[model samples]
Target chain A: MRIVVLTGGIGGARFLRGVRAYAAADGAAVTAVVNVGDDAIMHGLRICPDLDSVLYTLGGGADPERGWGRAGESWTVADELAAYGAEPQWFSLGDRDLATHLVRTTMLNAGYPLSAVAAALSRRWKPGVDLLPATDQRLETHVVVEDGDGQRAIHFQEWWVRHRAQLAARRFVFVGADQAEPAPGVCEALAAADVVLIAPSNPVVSIAPVLAVPGLREAVVAGPAPVVGVSPIIDGTPVRGMADKCLAAVGAQCSAAGVGALYGARSAGGLLDAWLVDEVDADAAVPGVAVHPVPLWMTDDDATEAMVRAALRAAQSR
Target chain B: MRIVVLTGGIGGARFLRGVRAYAAADGAAVTAVVNVGDDAIMHGLRICPDLDSVLYTLGGGADPERGWGRAGESWTVADELAAYGAEPQWFSLGDRDLATHLVRTTMLNAGYPLSAVAAALSRRWKPGVDLLPATDQRLETHVVVEDGDGQRAIHFQEWWVRHRAQLAARRFVFVGADQAEPAPGVCEALAAADVVLIAPSNPVVSIAPVLAVPGLREAVVAGPAPVVGVSPIIDGTPVRGMADKCLAAVGAQCSAAGVGALYGARSAGGLLDAWLVDEVDADAAVPGVAVHPVPLWMTDDDATEAMVRAALRAAQSR
Candidate 1:
């Protein structure tokens, strides 16, 4: 079986662990079309937060406790940067994490596209799944929020990390989505996939920005594969991260049914053919889409693999 | 009194400590025209090794034992970079040190000249002396060496750090020096100085590259101030660093008198009006320049201050 997973950072990375576990047992090929919307330049280093999370998590180097960055990471660089009084002090980049950014930035500046850089970096991580960025071009997710200074667009990192997503977000904007093309293998992966699974990542900011790429949404909707999504929300709340705030910004109810309906039936001008919600949301309903309730908490690899199996079953049924 | 010093990394930084101490007692203003020859980009970071050495040393952040970088610096970034198999692994940049480079590279990329960037960085260090780059433009000291690949020029850092300066070097090339102008305050500092002291730094790569800047050499040689040089070589050997290898590359003897004569006399269209050698080289002779022997080893701040006092005496005599 060939599987293509659309993913974001931390939560998606955890979900990928399950996917990898299931794929390993099933002898299935997996390709991850990772969202690059959270990528930003900090202290002159190009940092792809989502890509690094997946790389570190899958490569067995991620800080399991923190769910982001390298295990045993040091904050020497961040502290020193703060000492220098460089602006944007809110986002703390760990010393070990900064190395990945440095290498990525150097490669990107040397004319290599983001996809090639991700591939080069993966050589060290040996991330089991083929990880390709959603787009090689710039595609930052900007959050329009009402601050004391009025509504202003801020980078997704600043909005999420610095502000803790507390600011009343007006909407989310994918800055360069109109011009972005899918990374080298993205379209092909979608076309050749036996099934496509949407990770339990933030639907608004994470999956939305990936789909924002001009033709990316079209590729998945028109591709010859069954599309299934694992709901990031369970019991009207996000299992991890501030998906509630993101969903609220778009005026969507913070529930599995809301997200399911958001990524409506592909036959009805939407993306998903099936939606897998947590067992707690067994009563959730989405018009024109198959909704299945399954135990979705990714407590461990085995638990996550079970969720992946559930997602595969939904795809097969569809 | 207004004193101007031209210097490089490590040894020069230590020497500046003495200069600062002496200037404090004498209530004299000091300006440092630091060598940019040792500056290079590593992992896309603009690293000004000589400037940083002076900054960290004066700021009391330098590793006294290691003679470079932050005293309590960590190697997280270096280890991570190595794991990624990034190129130019020979020069290991400490985590704290990488922060300095990030700030500098960011500022430079934002269109700030190096002098301004150094000045901005100095706000934190408050390195007693006015620090200035020898030139604002690219002025890398490249060593011409013959290897299996035939005669080729490589960055001085690569030659020193990677090969350990073991390669047979033909000469040193001050790349981009011909078109390089003195950084913002360099020429002005020299013109208005009461005296100019050449710190006991590498004559071939350090002090030579400073002079290579267009009109900077002329300004120093023709300026009204008496120029006195402290010999990096003591007892026929460099007190520290690979000055001997550099001098050998330039076909000069590795001795106090040899260096003094290499600088020659201001009246003879060369540089120094006087030279200071170690007492061990009391017999050292420079035909057209006055040579004074004193303690050259910078054992401590007090010892360095004593040497600075001796250099001032030489300047007074001239």
Candidate 2:
């Protein structure tokens, strides 16, 4: 079976681990079209946080406790940068993580596209699934917020990491989404997909920006494949990160029901065919979209694999 | 008295430490005109090896044993870059050192000239002397060598570090030298100097590249300051680095006498008014230049200070 998954952030990395595990057992091919809204150049290094999370997790190098970055990462470089008072003091850039950025920045400056650089980096971490960026073009998520500057837009990383999303965001803007197209291999993967799973990531900033790529959403919705979206929100809170803050910026209720409606039924000019939520939110509903409830705590690989299995079953219910 | 010393490489760094110590006692303000020949962009980071050596040495951050880079530095980034199979694996890129390059590269990309970047970086080190690049423009020392591919030019670092100078160099080309002018403040420093000390660096690759700047050599020779050159060679060999190979590439004998004549008397249209050699080369002669001999070994700061004092005394003898 050909499976195409949309992934971003730490939550998506955990979800992809489950997908990889399930695909291994089913002898299925998995292609992960990763979000690039979080990618930014800082201190002359191009950093792709989402792609690195997936690479580290699937390649057996992720810190199990932190749920991101390398398992044995050091912070010598970051500390040195801080000592020099280089800006953005909030980033948790590790020494090993910096190596990835240095290589990526060099390649990108050499005129290689983001997708090609991702593929080159993947050679070191064989992340099982074929990793493709949502778009090769620059599409950044910037948050508009009221600050001392009085209504200014800041890059998503500054809003998410630097500010910890404490400052109330008015809205999220995908800077270049209108001009971006699905990167090479993205449309082909979606067209050939037997099942397209939208891994539980921030719907507003992560999945939205990926789908915002001009033709990406159309390809997934128009393709002859079931689009199953696992809820990033369990009950009324996110398992990780500040999805509540993000969802609030877009004026959506932070619940499985709200997310299901956000990624509405394809029959109603939306994206998802089926929406999977936790058992506690079994009453969640979206018109024209099949909603199913499953035990959704991804405590370990085995538990995540079971979650993936349940989500796939929900795909058939639609 | 105002002092302007030309410095490059590790040898020049050691020499400047002495100059700094001597100037502190004499209450003379010193400005160091440092070479930029060893500069290169690697992994998208601008690296000025000579400037770094001076910074680390004067800032009390240098590894005494290695005579270069930061003390107590780690190689997590370098090792990680190598694991990714990134090019130019021969660099001794420490985690701490990478921070400096990151800051420098970012500033350079932002359109700041090399001289301004040097001063900005000096704010952290407070190297106790004004650090000026020989030229703000791009002027690098490239060595033409006979490889299996026949005569080809490669970066000076590639020759010195990667090949360990095993490749016989045909000649040294100062790339971008013809169009380059002295960096801001360099000509002013030279014109105001009471004495100009040529630091004991590789005369060919190090000091020559700095002089290769269009009007730089003319400024020193024409200015009222007495220019005293300290021979890099002691007892017919360089104290450090491959000065012999470089000297041979320029078709000059690797001896104190040969070097003194190379930088012949200013009266004879050459750089030096006086040449200071080791006691072993006391008899070394340059027709119109005053040659003075002293124990030239930089065993420690005190020994280096004594040597500097001796070179300053030789300036009056001219």
Give the top-scoring candidate (DockQ): 1
Q: Please tell me how candidate 1 rates in CAPRI terms.
A: high
The sequence of per-residue lDDT tens digits that candidate 1 reaches over residues A1-318 is 999999997999999999999999999999999999999989888889999999999999999998889999889999999999998899999998999999999999999999999899999998899999999999999999997899899999999999899999999999988899999989999999999999999999889989999899999999999999999998998999999999999989999999998889998999889999999999999988899999999999999999999999999999
Error of 2 at A104 (Å): 0.6
Clashes of each: 0, 0
Ten residues in sequence with the least summed lDDT for candidate 1 chain A: A143-152
Question: Candidate 2 iRMS, in Å?
Answer: 0.7
Each candidate's lDDT (Cα)?
0.93, 0.92
Q: Lowest lDDT 10-mer window, candidate 2 chain B?
A: B259-268
- What is candidate 2's local distance difference test score? 0.92
- Assess each model's interface with DockQ, reporting 2 decimals per model: 0.95, 0.88
Report chain B TM per candidate: 0.99, 0.98
